[model samples]
Target: MLVFFIAHFVLHWGWLVLNTKKCFRRNKEIKADEIIEAKHTAID
Candidate 1:
């Protein structure tokens, strides 16, 4: 029973960490795209 509980906790934490990393990466990409767009608009 204790082992099952530990396994469940670890799985949940791993999922949360992976999701957070994915979200952070996506946000960074979006910001980078916005910056590029701004630079292009400025040049034009």
Candidate 2:
């Protein structure tokens, strides 16, 4: 059970990192902070 949990956590973290990188790459002109804010706004 612990191993499964750890695996899930690692995958989730990796996905988040990759997703963030993709977002950054999508807009080279925008700053990181702006991209983050735009993401949050789109989510909300």
Best by lDDT: 1
Q: Candidate 2: which stretches are off by over 4 Å? A: 29-44
Tens-digit lDDT track for model 2 on 1-44? 99999999999999999999998787775677798999999999
| TM of each candidate vs. truth | 0.87, 0.60
What's the C-alpha lDDT at position 12 in model 2? 100
Q: What is the Cα root-mean-square deviation between model 2 and the actual structure?
A: 10.6
Cα error, residue 30 of model 2, in Å, equals 6.5
Instruction: Give the residue spans of candidate 1 off by over 4 A.
Output: none
Candidate 1: worst-modelled 10 consecutive residues by lDDT: 1-10
lDDT of 1 at 40: 100
Q: How well is each residue in 1-44 modelled by candidate 1, as lDDT tens digits?
A: 99999999999999999999999999999999999999999999
Weakest 10 consecutive residues, lDDT, candidate 2?
Answer: 24-33
Error of 2 at 42 (Å): 30
